[model samples]
Target chain A: MNSSLITTKTQRHKEKHYEVSAPSVTQWWSWFKDHHEDTKSTKKNDMSSDGNNFRSALVIGYGNTLRGDDAAGVRVAEELARRHPALRCLSVHQLTPELAHDIAEVDRVFFVDADAMADHVYAESVEQTPARSVRSHSLSPTSLLSLARDLYGHAPRQAHVIGIPAREFDLSEDLSPAARTGVAEAVECVGAMLERS
Target chain B: MTKTITISPVTRIEGHAKITIALQPNGDVAETRFHVNEFRGFEKFTEGRLMWEMPGITSRICGICPASHLVTSAKAGDDILAVEVPETAEKLRRMLTLAQWLQSHALSFFHLSSPDFLLGFDSDPATRNVFGLIGHDKELALKGIRLRKFGQEVIEILGGRKIHTPWTVPGGVRDPLTAENRDRMLAWIPEARQTVGIALETIKKVHAKYKNEITEFGNFRSLFVGLVSKDGALEYYDGFLRIMDGNGNTIADKLDPKKFEEYFGEAVESWSWLKFPYFKQFGYPDGMYRVGPLARVNICDFIETPEAEEERKVFKKLSGNVGVVNNSFYYHYARCIEMLFAVEKIEQLLNDPAILGTTIRSQASINRTEGVGFCEAPRGVLFHRYKVNKDGVIQQANLIIATAQNNIAMNRTVHQIAAHFIDGKKGKITEGMLNRVEAGIRCYDPCLSCSTHALGQMPLHVELFDANGSLLDSVTRS
Candidate 1:
């Protein structure tokens, strides 16, 4: 019969503050990093052939995994981590300037997430990613790349983003028929990235 | 030489809030400020809109739990109209709120909070995510997914869409619940029960394993606020305002929901657009309190709903229930107990059968007036007070978000957690300490995006200070 469900107090601004919780969750429990760090190490291993290669890849996913297809970016990063142990991957609910480190030292980066364009007609395929499908902030790949450049140095030679068109991004498990299909298609895109490297 | 700790682009949490902790040479917390680098202006943007448009527009603030915002906003509109909502409308609204609470809470605990508790806070950060948790505890992951799905199912059946539905309007709901939707929810009852069972078992096991966390983690205490039955029973969906002290006595009660301004006041921060809402009587900063499940349970005597009350008794046995849950870390435990409340409330509402009746929503419109609406949102108390012109266009709006209520209390709670956990510890600050701190904040489940919208290039700075306010270290979020 027991039930459970799930604060900041008001305060004045003080001096310098660093996030105390960042170290714990970010250091040991980084799934994207675990999945991609192996590849980064492998890429480092490949660096034995080209020790000077500054190329690195970062993939960040945004959207809720609990609700069917909104978890596109997270799913791809998880899958990428599983298949390729050497690529650097960072998965997050949304993009932030704090993520610049993940984007740093990488030659090319690809970001994935569910696209929510206010004007985008919910058309069915990857074949139709018009500017209309481009949504507002919650982290955008282009904006993140710009931030990375501003913080870390130069932009990577190649930077791109892959988006999944969501039809019914409800709290439901059942994805709109179209979004369900994007999952496989997205996996293939990651696989192609893996092969390209 | 400098020492720096960074978790670039933090992962595995809802919203874009991130933590960056830099320590001093002595390894003390130099300065700590939880940062929400993302700018979302739902509050400001919604201005000049019609009162009825709020439920739809503001629901867009949070994609994860729009239903709660939708319902709360609608309730505010109802207050403005001063029309009594049909009983069917009220019951349906309760069901939707409970349903969303179940889904949102599951996402936070099982998917977001579980990694630290289950995989060990010190586990390799790379693999300590939901994906890793999935491989480590596949059954648990599946149950979490299923449980959230059930809640979403309830939302979808009633609202037509889970993310942002227009089913709820100003006077009442847009339409009545159909037999088909009602039956669909009924069919999922068995699975829902099973999922709750899994959650109860897993949390209990977690409690046994990390009893220290439940007790010693983030021991900050403050006034707890929530809605409660006049009899002091826990009531989330609809009830009068209640604020209880540490001694569990009501400091403020039966305050008209519309007259919240008389009891509460808002203050602004130069650093962030988020406002700090404090108790008017107690004054600012010091008057800070926390809401959400832990606070809700702390303030109420018993849950009026049958099964929820029984669950409360058992939850109380865990570290004395609300009595034992003085620390913020226990918020996670308290959250699971709330899941039980949501489940129980849903069952009670559904069986009424009249909940599925033909009459739903009131049909009334306010010409223009100043009105206040209060509802115990899943997070805690959400107060939406608006002033509109003759045409029902909003002239001014004030929202006392549940997170803002705990603003000052959260900062103090951080101090509490840090002081207790790190007392006399040798060597460098361990990752566990960091996790514990984040866990404490997680207890309140602050949704920064929904909290405020400050724009125009935020300065990225997080500093940890010692007791005397000496800067230990500073890190920019950007």
Candidate 2:
């Protein structure tokens, strides 16, 4: 909304995008380019190549791995890493306020969680809300986005929650068949989104 | 007829609890109770698990201080194996514990209790929180955030993630300290030291203004308990148990934690899920003792670092150097000093040459069927005990958390505050009176989750009971 930067507003848009000429954005873009170049040179001698150049994205996958099928989010994150080697992914037990710092550095974020109440893999766009002080062990993804915007001075340009339906959350290590199927669908959906970007 | 008042699910603390105040026929306060509403059968659930999995499993008891559980469980495992952990691993664990102390204490002092001191107790309840503190002093609020972040950052560097990192294991830790982590932690020391220094100074100055409140707010004589080094210096990671009388006399020194059952007794009441732990020497209610920062400061002969040592001297002077401080409100001061000591200790550990050694773990099999582990958790001294079969599967488990240990003392403090603040004949309680009652419990920073861990969104409820044991009035907060 600042007058110094170019902005666009649209009516039929389910997604919001901004074109920025801010010096900070320019600096971050150059830094990412340099980092990508360094990564390419470092892996120059590797035999097998992961060809996809991941765009600026932050994927946060959180769930208790100790609880069966609840690890679906982490599993999808692992799958995404294999398919898009350069993507930034964080696997956590829960989302904490500290992650707001990381969220500020990216242009896009995806919060993946196992939804026991869901029927199938689902994805929804997350818009930042006014940040409020939370008095709990963890914060919701939207709350984290709000925190990043209010406290850290920058929020991700886009964010979404990729929910994978989970069938079991008992004391077992292996995922349920339903959760496995859901993870596959989730992987395809999230992977396609990244590819299109 | 007598009447009772209830304050349900005390807010701004970890976990859920309610306070019940009973009044006599003449409208005089008779009894006050702090009831823990949730309980998790952790001991029963861990019965069939392998002893080695305890460090990870038990760490889930409380998300706020999982490192304490992890370290204590690992130590219990050490006792089972009967093997001494390597020196480097011990140093690394010490660093981890100190980091936990920093974060936990910061949360208690700055986020939880600071509002009571900063914003007057009579301030609007809606605004009496960390956000309120932010409105009053943005710099201080930001400083607290960064301070907590620094502590969590250290934990992340040591283990892998901040919460519930399975870095520590039996006989030692699984990872060695790296030069990068060491340097990063050291760089944070100066700023941390500055922030705590300012906090200490601010607390001391403000404490003088609340003299009347301090004297009347849960200020009573009770036994104090904590861990102390061999020379009776403050020790958090490993030390001998030291118990002191209200007047600064030693009740017991160098008590072995394995023999804790002999000196400590846990009593349960029908009204609450939390156990009331008391010193065995006096029996039941008479042996009630306070723990956490107040107990640690009172039990220690001296602090290690010069800066904290100076604060200790000031603290003692305030308490008339009687070797014990009876006032519960001084918890804020003691917490600040301990945080200073923790930072200093962290800096010292990081500079130790052996800290970065690769010899982090020692391997050993179960040598004992029964074992005990003890450490001074951020709240107070915590004990983990387990009895295992020959195959290394746990047969029984017992955990004495810091909050549970201070349960009796917390209850007594509530009674004391209610007696002083609540005027039964007035037939009405002011919001400030309720705030005072809640403040008394906050002094201990009781984590109901650590004491009686549970899940479910239970709305906070407070019910009043008459002398005939019937409900008179009730209040619920969501």
lDDT of 1 by residue, B1-478 (tens): 2233433223333445545444455655544445554555445655688998888766656655678777888877887788888889888888888887888788777767788788887786555655466558766766776677688778877886434546887777877888777777888777777777677777778878876766666565567777887787787767787887655557888666667788777877664445777888888876777788888777778886676677677766654533634667667767777887787778778888788677776777684487666677667788777788877888888777776677666656555565556522243345566656666666677766542111112333344444344555454433
- Supply fnat for every model shown: 0.00, 0.05
Candidate 1: docking tier: incorrect
The DockQ scores of all candidates, in the order shown, are 0.03, 0.11
- Candidate 2 steric clashes: 4
Error of 1 at B224 (Å): 0.5
lDDT at A160, model 1: 51
Considering summed lDDT, which 10 consecutive residues are worst modelled in model 1 chain B? B451-460
What does candidate 2's lDDT look like per residue over B44-133, in tens digits? Answer: 878999999999888866767888988999999999999999999999998888898898888777767787789889887666766577
Residue A133 CA displacement from its true place in model 1, Å: 26
Span of ten consecutive residues with least summed lDDT in model 2 chain A: A3-12
Per-prediction interface RMSD in Å: 13.6, 5.0
- TM-scores of the candidates are 0.68, 0.82
Q: Candidate 1: where is the Cα deviation over 4 Å? A: A1-197, B1-11, B18-26, B38-40, B318-324, B420-430, B450-478
